[model samples]
Target: MNINIFRRKRKIIVPVLTEEKAKETLVRCQSCGNLIEYEDLRKNLKVCPYCGYHFRMTVSERINLIADSGTFSEIDTEIKAVDMLGFKDLLTYKERIKQTKKETGLDCAVITGKAKIGGFNAAVGVFAFEFIGGSLGSATGEKLTKLIEYAKKHKLPLIIVFSSGGERIHEGIYSLMQVAKIIQAVDSFKESGRLFMPVLTNPSYCGAAAIAMTGSIVIAEKGSLIGVSGPRITREVANKNIPGKLKQAESLLQNGFLDTVVDRHLLKTTIAQFLKHYNRRTI
Candidate 1:
């Protein structure tokens, strides 16, 4: 069968989104009342367009900004939690673990790795707040131990970025044991004469704050919360009105708990300088 058919070509219109188009909708800076483009804000690492105030960053973002490009080698990637007690609160412990894994793309709160800061090799560990409120559990403790061992073996300095709610309540005693475990790990690193620097981010409370303070050079982000207990708990236990910024980073600095309070905008540069100073001092 032969049939003559007239074929017509259809023109397809595709929509392309660009920064200029996005900027047509203005976003005011939280710190300063200045209109700016969303793309520009992100490009500047979430700093305020006018005031230069830094926005809170995620653990992964911090790692990417601090570590030298293409130098991050992750450690203890396969260590995961096991529900030994079968505990349950509002949700099953096992289900909670699974959900955290799915949400954070991590088996545990801490990600241990090796990376370079200002060309100096170091062991890096970053705690993910998205993972069970960055709880310190058995897995987190084990990873910290391994990181210390790795640093000691290679004679590399250790840098830990800490932000956690404290010990994992669901894990009970197992979680509490991490405090001793990580402290011992830090002690081992100290005995090896290696430098340990812990940079505390916002809400570095409970076990995270305790372990992070073990560093020889402890630095905290400005405006961060650094304490053993949250405000609610402190108020409940103290049975009094607590100051609004009682446990803030600045308060900790005033109390000599933190070695330094660093601005988030210059965090990477400051950390790099610290690593450089330590490398020179050790050598």
Candidate 2:
């Protein structure tokens, strides 16, 4: 597969509430150059009709795809990112949080909850890349840790869908600390002999990559990328450009970094099948 095709700029399809708005919206596939109606694209699980390119999905879309209908119950809804250090760039951390919340309707980059997946209950957390690139912040880590603990208590399977860019820079050291906290939580969860399934999606970098790699089974969406650091940082540190195929899911599967690379359409079915197998073994 030519991973270069994924590097091209594609039209961003904003979710519209009304049917009329959805009908009026059109997105162009970056890989195949096909014009796709927003409604049709959504019904097709946001995969391009012509080229089968898997487009990035929001947290709600992802949850809907994987979780059984009306079975997800969210936890830690009140926890939100704050301006811990009063960090400022062009915008203050407070301003950025407010703006991101308004834009994405999310309190943090990830949402954690108890959900029935393929009719089996599990603890699930999903990351939305639009929320500050799904960066891991203090609140994000807290929620995930709590979720892992909940799963541990209940002896339920843990599933985390990672689509993060890196640690949230606005929180500085606080953001970095989350990696340690989460790792501790994950360790405790694993001691109970429960399964940890990490589904890596597009742009899983830095701390996200570390956590996902620790899972019992590492799964990746087709066309996703998994790397320690992004291109700019790699160029500065290593004095070289990131190899095009180095982080691609297909390449990772070949090199044994991932257990499987699943298509977006088949993800729910595949995951359910795994859960069934795990359940049978445990029983």
Best candidate per lDDT, number? 2
What lDDT would candidate 1 get against the real structure?
A: 0.80
Q: Candidate 2 — which residues are off by over 4 angstroms? A: 1-23, 232-239
Best candidate per TM-score, number?
2
lDDT of 2 at 117: 92
**Shift in Å, residue 134, candidate 1:** 0.6
Model 2 global lDDT (CA atoms, 0 to 1): 0.88
The clash count of every prediction, one per candidate, is: 0, 0
- Clash total of candidate 1: 0
Each model's TM-score, in the order given? 0.84, 0.90
Off by over 4 Å in 1: 1-41, 48-54, 236-239
lDDT of 1 by residue, 130-228 (tens): 687788889988998899899999899999998787998878999999899889989988998888999998778888898888889999887788888
Q: lDDT per residue, candidate 2, 1-283, as tens digits?
A: 2333234564444332234445678887766888898888889998988888887888899999999999999999998988879888767889889998887788899999999999988999999888988999999999999999999999899999999989998899999999999999999889889999999988799999999988998899998878988765676567789886788899989998899999999999888988999899889
